[model samples]
Target: MSYLDPAIAVIDPVAAAGPYGREGTAIGFRVICVLTQEYRTPYVTQTFDPADFSEVYQHSCIDETVAFLKSRSVVAVVPGAPPSLKIVDVLAESLGLIGNPTESLEARRNKRVMKEYWTRHEVPCAAFHESGDLESVISWADGRGYPVVLKPNASVGGVHVFVCANRQEVVDAFNVIVSRADPYHQQFSTVLAEEYLDGDEYFMDLAHTGGGEAMPVAFAKYEKIQRNGNASIYKNMFSLPLDDPIALAALPYVRSVNDALGVRYGINDTEFKMTSRGPRVVEVNNRLPGASVPLMIQRCSGLNVFQENIRIFVDGRRTSGDYHFERHYNICCLINDQPGVVQGYAGLDEVRELLSYDGERMIAPQGVHWPVTRDLDGCWGLIRLVHEDREQLSRDAEAVHAMMRLLVA
Candidate 1:
């Protein structure tokens, strides 16, 4: 396969000190690092910055990134995170690289903006309004109905996302959200108050080839755990059959949302809640999936989302087949609800024996300080079980949850 250049530019791949920044470089792709403001604190303490990349350029401004790419004769730009998506889109636009329309970046990042655009385009979306005033937000939600969702206009992994049932809950939620700072160090003063869509929730993953076709790769139905009108835990995610009725109905809406947003090329992670009427989009992420989604997909489907994404950007290639896997898969994640220092864990040996498989983990090793679950990243780790029978998978998930425990001090 031919790549645009021997060296591809990757922007702010998590902490520069980690293996993520060197991922492409290790795989025979020359990856140049473009530093952004959101890198991890450990990276800074280690003095191991992205600038240490073999062929690196550090710039905070998007315009500067374009200039650096031009100066370095860069061919392809790969964004590593949500914040970098817009920057890379801008670079792609300015440098004539294959990517989604740069104008869509605003809608891609901001939920409020995306909902507005979707409403204007008649795309299926729950009722939403953006405002800093708690009373105004409550008024909008009151008009709609109970169980309104309040979330930061731009945040990740359901951080500070609240589902309120009444006026007091909405007031408390808005205050709590606005008090916290986002990844970009900006206060979430303006939140998006949305009518909480009641139904089954599912995520559809797609690859938008610059060639004008959006290819479906994978789909999963999520089961969320709610606490005090807040989604503090994300439980089981079951892979839906390709021919499932819900999957079939949601595909067109996914395509329509991408097209309406002027997404010509990129990976799309679109979440939809199936209402009594039909499927309505809850959120759209114009980037790769989070957590172990990529690994799980590759394990089950034999399709690597990262490699396919690279091909889309560098080779302008897109797959043209229906997505399916040979086996059924179920994934479950855990969140730390108790706040304390981590001493050790229990029930793992029994859990492994019961499940007969060791799933992927993302927990902080023992002795590390563990925080209470407040948002998505508070998740401890995940366990994915493969089963040919869907019913058996559900039974195994319950056994895992009952047996596994995260011990806290």
Candidate 2:
């Protein structure tokens, strides 16, 4: 499924540009880097820098973007983040490129809208209410019961999400959620409060064709670092065996949620809570799975989520062949709770010896004062580990946690 010269327009690949270029190389497509900043990366074949009019969705900027696309016949447009997705949707629709509708992107990016859509379509989800009024949210939570999850209407990486067990906590958490919204997107201020479903959490990464079909690449079970049994400050995700019964059982619900969202042409990261009633949708994001998931999935299984999305859009199909699911149980740990300046890392040589990792990945740059993590985005660093046996995995996780110290000032 290698393309000879299929030019793909990618919008704002994050981390100063690496993923998009790697994706292009993986699929043999020439990536046209369309960015918001004057960032440079070695992976892209060509680059285009337009005016900052799109920060306000300016008409002139859109015209320039269209003009640039016309200069090269792009086979598809791939957006990295939610904001970038909105921009690409507008540009793709204008240029007749493959992408989601603007309205769908808008709705999907907002939690309130996505929940309403799921509710209308009879999708299995938690009871939720939204308002700028904290009193109303408190009332709704009171009726629902002890715990409720408050989150910003529009966000990424679990930003401004709080689990409140009481009315006062709800008020404090709601204010935090509201204040965390992006200033430009006013609708984001409308916070959402949902009846928190306490259960085991899991996530699935997959690619969809927008044709009512989804191909699951990898599945994971999460272990949350909870504070006072309410707020999840950190997340430890372990890649479940692909053929595990729990993983198999969640596929139908995943497909239903994907179809309900009208997902067509992109990678999706869907997180859910497996309650006593059944699996309930926590959130469905139309984007690539973050952190070390893409690499972990490739290590555990032959299927590459990023490349699969490209193949889905360009070739109108997924990677052909059975996945060689390695028996390795991979764990991705996000150290969010530890806060301070990173003086140095202890047991670097020992941890590196015990764990399998790419040499380039580290906790974070040292000496910068680190703040207390309030959400998933504020996580300090990612530590990836893998093992073949469950007992060995548990033993390795403990050893790594104890030895891989983030020495803070």
Write the residue-wise lDDT of candidate 1 on 28-56 in tens digits.
56567776664542212232345435565
Residue-level lDDT tens digits of model 2 in 1-409: 2335667776765541235566665657766667643333211212223321122112237789787777767777776545565577778788886777776776567677778888888888988999889788988999989788887776665666778878888888877766644312333566788888878989987677666457677788887765643355555677786677987898888888766666777777899988999999888877777666777776667666667776665655766643556745545454634678878777667867764543325545588676565545456556677666666666666766676666778
Cα error, candidate 1, residue 243 (Å): 2.5
What TM-score would each prediction reach against the true structure?
A: 0.90, 0.86
Q: Pick the candidate with the highest TM-score.
A: 1
Model 2: lDDT equals 0.67
Q: On a 0 to 100 scale, what is the lDDT of residue 109 in model 1?
A: 80
Query: Per model, how many backbone clashes are there?
Result: 0, 1
Q: List runs of model 2 lying over 4 Å from the truth.
A: 1-4, 15-17, 36-61, 181-187, 228-230, 321-324, 334-338, 355-360
Clashing pairs in 2: 210-264
Residue 72, candidate 2: Cα error in Å is: 2.5
Best by lDDT: 1
TM-score, model 1 to reference: 0.90
